[model samples]
Target: MERRKVDVAVIGTGTAGMVAYKAARKHTDNLVVIEGERYGTTCARVGCMPSKLLIAAAEVAHQVAGADMFGIHAEHVSIDGKAVMARVRRERDRFVGGVLETVDGFPAEHRLQGMARFIDDHRLMVDEKLEVEAGRIVIATGSRPNVPDFLQVAGDRLLVNDSVFELENLPDSVAVFGPGIIGLELGQALSRLGVRVRMFGVSGNLGGIRDDAIRQYALETFNQEFPLDPSAQVNRVERTDKGVRVTFTDKPKGKSPSEVSEDFDYLLAATGRRANVDHLDIQNTGIELDERGTPIFDHYTLRCSKDHIFIAGDANKDVPLLHEATDEGRIAGDNAGRYPDIRSGMRRAPLSVVFTDPQIAVMGLTLDQVKERCKGYYGVGEVSFEDQGRSRVIGKNRGLLKVYGERGSGLFLGAEMFGPAAEHIGHLLAWAAQKHMTVTEMLDMPFYHPMIEEGVRTALRDLNYKLNIDPQMIDRALECGPGA
Candidate 1:
């Protein structure tokens, strides 16, 4: 076995691992990044970039077909499923190229192209050949799409986001196994592409929004485009001559069929993803794992059981979004390089978004998180897109925005909203929450006329009223001196 020693070793060349390497490089060049697969980050290769490309194509097809609603006689807008998919892949490859180029630029000796397993606290074996001794290690292996055991027999009929994006053509119809963000985004996009789609959610919630109003609106809107049943629980899956069939139990109340036997050209099992830690040989590192088999790491510092070891990204089973992964990678890398006298960073306010039409967004603390943290005394308010002028003018009046605040102090706590450009709205609120801004402080800022951002103004206004706050402070313009 070849023996090597490095100051730091990073496993997995995905988003988290790559960021860890880049951040660690600032401290020392004595580091190596090991890869078990392709080098492109998840955002560039499969998760974000390609999925958005496909969604854009589907959106175009949907818009052209609905042009008649705008008093314009739109002609037949036939969809070229094959061409659309091909274009997405072509563009997606370009994004992946940048990531590959960056990885390739690293010193040849600093990159290890193989799977790595922990041998001990500070040692790893790469590809059953190289034994790497490191002062510290950062594990950022990311995750893989979770599919139940029985569902795998369907073979090619079963699709995950990774395989789904690589398809040369779209299937005629699909039965989505989860109505979460990934499922809803692709499910709606597929429907807009003229694919017959039926979606099954684990529970009543939609796209991770626990806010009752936003979740309900998301369900109602997505249901208008495709069939989505929130009460569905898939129990069995089998292959058939026509396509794949799925059996679901606990049908929704007052539904047509007592049992659901859904048949479609494809079965998308997007329930969620599982951490990719099984192959890491974590037991050798003496790290304690959570009930989910993920390593128990410090939330603030991203440190594992051993001071020199850290876990980040989906492998930790916490925040799996691209941006969160980047932050975590930086934190882990910084600590891994510095070691013993470790420095830690504060966790960012939580922000998650779903890229569907009238997108769903959750910013900072959720309602439940807020209730627990604030003792259920937070003031709440909401606004409907149907009641908003911009949404009405744009002819996309279908969403809801709800904001929460501290009762007396009226501090902006967090929000869950589903509306046009909810991603941007989510960002705006997350920034405010991070700065510990109050409702009056948020309102002091300018809100452009006839825009989706006005929705924030409305929600904040309503929240102030709930707190019985005098509208004079918010309604008045900013001035250096009072009554000047």
Candidate 2:
């Protein structure tokens, strides 16, 4: 067997792994990155970029269909399934190609092509062909879609996000399971593309929104577009001669609910994901693991058990977003490269966004987190888009925004918003939270008229009053004018 030694070794070449490799390279010349499969990020290959491309197409179709609300008419707005999938695949390949180029540019000696398994804390065996001993190690193997075994009844008709983009043409009908971010985004997009979609979730959750009012509003709004059961009692999922058959009990709001049977061309599983550490045989490393079998690591430093081993990105399953993965990778790589002289990396404020029609976003602390951390000293401010001038003007008068602040200090704690332009608004609030700005201070920022941002100002004003930092708002005085 071939034997090799390096200062640092990184497993996986996805976003986190790639970033970790680069970060470690800055500290030492002896570094290697291992890949067992194709070299591309989950975002570029199956997670973010491709999914957004599909959603973009769906958004165009939806806007054209709803143009009549603006006194404009569009004729024969047809979506070609083959053409849609073709563009998605074609553009997706372009993104993946860029990642391949980056990986190719890495020094040949620093790239390994075999699967890596732990032999010990500082040792790894690659496909039983090579043995590697390193001073430090970083694990960024990322994650894969977690499909329940019961869904196997669909057999060949089942699909995950990885395979969904590979379809030649969109299916006529699909039964989507899980109402979290993935399920909600894909289900809504497919529905807009003229596919018969029925989404189901075991728990009454919508887009992972923590605020009750926003979750309820989102549930009602999405149900208007297609059938969705947040809490479904599925009896059986079986394969049919043509495709798949699902038996369930759906409880519709304000109606007699009973058993229902449905058939679809495919069963799309948007259920959560499992971190890829299971295949590494981490138990051999003597690292402490949680009940879920994941390594116990420090969030700030990304250290697993000691200074020599680290875990980052979805492998840790702390924050699964791409940006968080990138940051964690940098921290882990930097610490691994520096080893005994480890230092904590800068951790940013919490922020999450779901790119649905109305958009769902949360910044800094969530309502639950604030309640727990601040006890009974936090106040909430809210604004509804139903009558907001800009929202009414744009025909996007749906959803709500709630901002939280501390009662004593009037410091902005966090926010949960299910409303228009939330993706952008979430960023602004995140900046404020990171800077630890007060509610009155955020309200002091300029507010432009007839824009979605004005809605944010309204919520801050309400929060200011609730925190006793300002007086109550006057009736109808907040809005500028008709459709302003």
Residue 258 local lDDT, model 2: 89
In the range 84-120, model 2's lDDT, one tens digit per residue, is 9999999999999999999999999999999999998
**Candidate 2 all-Cα RMSD:** 5.4
Tell me the deviation in Å of residue 40 in model 2: 0.2
Instruction: Return the top candidate by lDDT.
Output: 2
User: Which parts of model 2 have CA positions greater than 4 angstroms off?
Assistant: 469-484
TM-score of each: 0.94, 0.96
Model 2 TM-score, 2 decimals: 0.96
Q: Which parts of model 1 are misplaced by more than 4 Å?
A: 233-235, 248-256, 468-484
- What is the lDDT of every predicted structure here? 0.85, 0.90
Model 1: lDDT equals 0.85
Q: What C-alpha RMSD separates each model from the true structure?
A: 4.3, 5.4
- In order of listing, the candidates' clash counts read 0, 0
TM-score of 1: 0.94
